[model samples]
Target: MSLVLAGTVAGLVLGDAWLWVAVEWSPPAYAGFYASGGFDTPTTVALLVAAPVKAALLWLILRAPAPGPLDRRARALRRLLYLAVAHALVLWYPIALLPDVVGAVFQLALWSAIDVLYLLVIRWRSRMLRAAAGVAFAVELAGTADEVLDELDLPELGSSEVAAAVLMLGGAAAIIITLVGQRRDGRWSRGTQAAGWLSVGVYALVIPFGVFFEGIPGGGPVLPVVMGVMALVGTVWLAATARELPVEDRPADPPPARRRVTRVAVAAVAMLPVIALIHPEQTPHLTHTGWSPACYDRPGFGDLKPAERDAAFLCRARSTDGGVPPMFPDGLSDQEVLAYGRVLCRAKDHDEQEAVLTRAGSARAAWGADPWDLVYVCPEIVGAAHPELLRSAAETEAANDAHIAEMNAECRDPWPRTKGVVQATARYFLFADGDHGYLVHDPGDESAEGEMDQAIDELYDDGDALVGAVGSTVLVGHVEDVTDLCLTVKAFRTAPPRRLAGWDQVTEVPVVSRSGRLTVPELDGGDAGAGAPMPNLAIAGKGRYRLRVHVRVGDAGEEHLVVVFPGASRKRLELKS
Candidate 1:
């Protein structure tokens, strides 16, 4: 009865956690940004996927169990425990992947050894599954807090000395509640907990190797799916524990372990959070090393193992002579050579670095705006030299400036003075990070993906456009029909309300005005920069400006309210009477 009760409680808490994430935790703004913009990050994906799995398992548990319910419940509860640990491992494993195949194996081997040794030497196992689960939960919500805070820009919450991530401890709280409640039921013996942790740890060690080397079913996001499956089964197992059964069927607890080792287990489990918190920034590394490429020698990374500390940081490595790297087309890969060049570019002496800068400048003149070339790579190495790279083509810059001035004078400012409409393709539009995703995605280009579906059913989902904006530039979506898209423009001195009444969706982006005139081009047109000239909005002086795009749809066509502010884009554009 106690086991059933505990299992029932565990089922409820797990369901609740899923409910909390799906409903209360995920903000509309942040979640929508990710969903529509196609920014499916790992943590975001895990949180979304785990919630549904837990919910489904909760449903499965609610149904009547087959004969021998007690045994089924016990097995299910054990899987549930493993599932919890799997969620925790999702965050830790990504850090390990960047390290070479051998480094990953070694880390897992050491962990497995310690896990085995705990049982052999101390006669018991220590598990930090819950603590790790907590850290993973915190990390997931932290991204949400960051995104929301970025949008809201609250002074008190945003300006605080404490990291905004700390505020997103709701996930940690949910896991803690589930673990604490499970402890209330004595049926959750130390042996049962140990077994569950062991199973999950093995999965963590084994899965990454297959993902990194052997290849998983999905090309990407295999970890989240793997963790979600473990958790799914685990939840179902817990729910089964609530089944009606005899008390005599309950599993027996193992004998108590050595007294001294209890502290060891607790202390060791406590350190897992420390290890989980240190997220290292990525360094450019074409080759796999003994440690994660990102695990450079930073002071606070004391939590990192010794192997990681010893490996030279990929970015700062120098040649044999400690001078500039070997000339282009050396033994090193282009990326490695670039890293060395960047090292020389950052050097203090201009006279010493002048040769490289001059060469990069000449390359810029020859390449002329082709991306990923020498001109593009050098700027990140020395940002101040960005203009210097461009200045090599003085005649070109002058011609471009003259062209801009000519275009600005020929501004297509049409609205209050003359009434007309702009043409739009259809309903669903998207504002995304990459320009090529929705526009001009070359059919032959293998690298271009995650955009474009020609099927008409994709356009008819709900009739409303599923447009989103992660950044200002690219907008793409499905629309079955093309129609006249009209716009009502207003200019404000101050930043206006982000959304307006009756608009389906609204977003704002900062746009630069070099000629005091900015154009609103076809964001969701056929080919990029291929159609007719777009109308321009003129401002008084040069600087930064904001474009607040308010979109709404009707049976006839889609309507847009473009509000322009010096920054807010809120001021009313009072026409000259």
Candidate 2:
């Protein structure tokens, strides 16, 4: 009953471990197989079934007649097998539970060794079976070490490929030598015969697939599937042969439990070096949060492209000055960081944008939140540029109300007035950063304007229009990168809200702006000296209005909102009325 209870507990522990692996490490398609609730019914049922099955098998084996006194060689092999099983089982725990294929192959070999060794302990003499299992054990041990070295990104110990080749060649030679010279028991159980054939068959199948079809370290499912089949077959064979042990006279009284424990402890000490070699946690490119290619050796970003380098520069400056990344703890992926760089590069002042990012980062840190969480959701980083941090909520609100009133009267109002001064602001837009790039129409001809436009246009598809209209200047440049870029425009009353929407409106401009830029073609084809400016999106009422232009470049579309302010025109037109 004690042995039965121990088997039951072992079964439960193993089943729970398997369940944990399935839930946390399985591929997305397979995760759901065992990831239901706290009390997983399938896992529970499997564990319970295994408990009684294993318990019964143990009871039968214990009840069987004991073996006659072993010869010197047999006793040595028994001790060696015990050591191998103990050390290999520890290594196999994490490796078998890993969801990847490289692990599965190692796990199959370790499991096979354990099974064959256990059978030998019970005196099921099969020399051919022992030889095949021994060969598999050697190959898997070398293969697992090779794989672990590569996964850890450690310096190679010779070539893993060469090592695997030599190990496999030796195993093949051992199998041939055993088959020619060794012998099996005259009367083998059907299960034992089947298990032996299956073992050889699996060993033959794994080598070629692992070498030619699938490269070592990582790949498709051939090896994993073969290993899985091997495990299933080995388990079935173990169960079938559990009752086929040879009858023997009762042996001398069993050794004391304390003596047995001491022997086991001595074996473990002898195999410490073997156990120390299997370190899976040291594998590279993995972190507590998750695997991110973006996090790999990206310190200086020397490997990045030119634009990504600029992003890296900006990130470095921000971190140096503000003690935080503009993005976050891990930073953005290559393209995203570049896009953000383009946005910052286009700003009228680099110092201002850096200051804004710094303040934002500081605020996020104060709140114990990620910098990216603040930046992605923050509104202050929008438009030609963000303004100074509002000192007070009331002051922010008052400024917002005044700006809205001015915009409504000059840009949103519908009226005819005397020609007012046409102010021209040379705003620049960049598109190189993919989806994260924004269109800006600021008031100034900064030195970085052309560069910013070039980068932004790089993001545009060929034949796409580069529409820029600020104050009275509207010039459309064609996207020369590819021929699929085009423009779409719309009007709206309110700007789109960002992820963090509850921020004070007075501190930041709305995403939509009527006076920022224009993409609407002018009616009557009027040229504004240099080129055709987009038609003046003139508002004819004393209210707020927004013109949203959507530029479709390839599969993605970018939206630019310019809130048109008529300025003094609305008052002059009202006076005329």
Candidate 3:
């Protein structure tokens, strides 16, 4: 028994040391789901409780007289082991109360299973005690019902978090108190004392640090292998020790039955908790489960393993459905639209991505008009991975040109003669960041250049120039060739299609000037590398104004439309298509 405790102590110490090595070698990549780790909170709470309980059991066992009959020492050890398990059940109770009903059944079935095992070992006495414990636990917690409710309503905490925290704490305290009451000692061993304390001390430090900090470095794979091994070893150790003790000299239970039954019962007792939590939604922290996966597979997806469903549901996907990034439901900002483009860039489901883009572009338009997002989505994906289902950039641009040439054949309204409005054009190589200019209220700010610098990763990863943000500025993307661009300015009385087709995008942005006037930068395609930012043309006084920039693409060039209004938000509205 003492030797078994020593192995546990050694395992705990070595595991923590390995953890330090892993963290130094390969720290967490805090970008993925779960802040990029597994179910961090519940697992941490479990470890905090389990460590001290196991330590107390080891101490109770060591205090017993060496390898003797079923005495006071043996009974005390058994009761402490029971307390460790009941504490685990207490931990599961709140976690099981998640969003679905499957979790609830799993929880109750698990409690029933544990009761079966408890009765076979400790007889009828354990059940009576368990029922009494349950009653007392409820009564004790009833006093703080209002506090729990208040905590749940807080913005930082919710039903899942608050309930788990409160119940887990109560469970831990109950476990410790129950173990303390069964304290049996003549203080038989100092070496055993060292081993038990060492296990408790190391576990308390390592588990919490691993959870709340940068996360276990190689913890993704390393943790499960180490924990699984420890569990197997502990089960074997306890089972072997239990064989030596005589719980009773009753007639119905023979020697052979006691030997085989006792060992098997001990093993099942250790494993019942593991069996209870097999649902994909409630990820098993002690075992290997994909808490967050990279690729999402819809019903029509060719071949893939099941990822955590909660993650997919968050992306608005389900078992038979496809998903989009969490955007589009609310009014979008320029940054949000830019961020959505980035998600589309990395999407594996090319067909689904294209469908989402095309559908959003075309069908959502009210009357007969063009899509505002016609300039977006595909170009963004092209810059990233070149989505499989979409056409090549050359083909798409050629189609856009032919589409515009057809639209230009229709009679259109003349450009509006309005103040606070001017048109400027430039030659930009689409794939290259050559000489593409932007619309800004402050010509002197140069923050647009800083904004360009901020998009270095996008540029490096996908050769993209289209996505960026700076204060009071809206940037443009690169084109395939240095195409001839014609600028056009307009002011809309009401939101409607200024033209029937050929419009790629029309979105809003703020333009402010305290000096009562500012210069709009001219794009002359000179030696400045990116359209030569030498100030030139028109100026306008502004007070609180927003620019609704319109981009209409054609074979000849792109006609940019900037419609000045009194608001600032990046909303890609539908034109009557």
Q: Candidate 2, residue 360: CA error in Å?
A: 42
User: Across residues 200-232, which tens digit of lDDT does each residue of candidate 1 receive?
Assistant: 333344434443334222334335344444544
For model 3, how does the per-residue alpha-carbon lDDT over 16-112 read when each residue is reduced to its tens digit? 3323222211122321222344435443343334444444554443344334455564555555444433334244445545643444344334433
Model 2, span 1-577: residue lDDT tens? 3654564465456654443333222333332333433335544554444445444433433333234465554454444443443333234455556755666455445545544544355432556666565665556455555555666676644465576567665544443333222224322243333444444444555554443334222333323433443443333333333333332332233457745664554455335435534446533211211132222333322234544434333343234234433333333333443344445444455465555445444333332322222232222443113332312345555675564344323321111131222222111223433332333332232422464455445334433334433333333343333211222222323343321222111111112223443333321222111111333333333323332232222233221223343233211111010
Global CA lDDT of candidate 3, please?
A: 0.38
Q: How much lDDT does each candidate structure score?
A: 0.39, 0.37, 0.38
Could you give the candidate ranking by TM-score, starting with the highest? 2, 1, 3
lDDT of 2 at 371: 28
Clash pairs, model 1 backbone? 76-237, 79-234, 80-234, 429-467, 430-475, 491-571, 492-571, 495-568, 564-569, 565-569
Clashes of 1: 10
Which stretches in model 3 have alpha-carbon errors above 4 Å? 1-160, 170-210, 213-577
Between prediction 2 and prediction 3, which has the larger TM-score? 2
Q: Pick the candidate with the highest lDDT.
A: 1
* Poorest 10 consecutive residues by lDDT, candidate 3: 365-374
For each of the candidates, give the backbone clash count.
Answer: 10, 25, 12
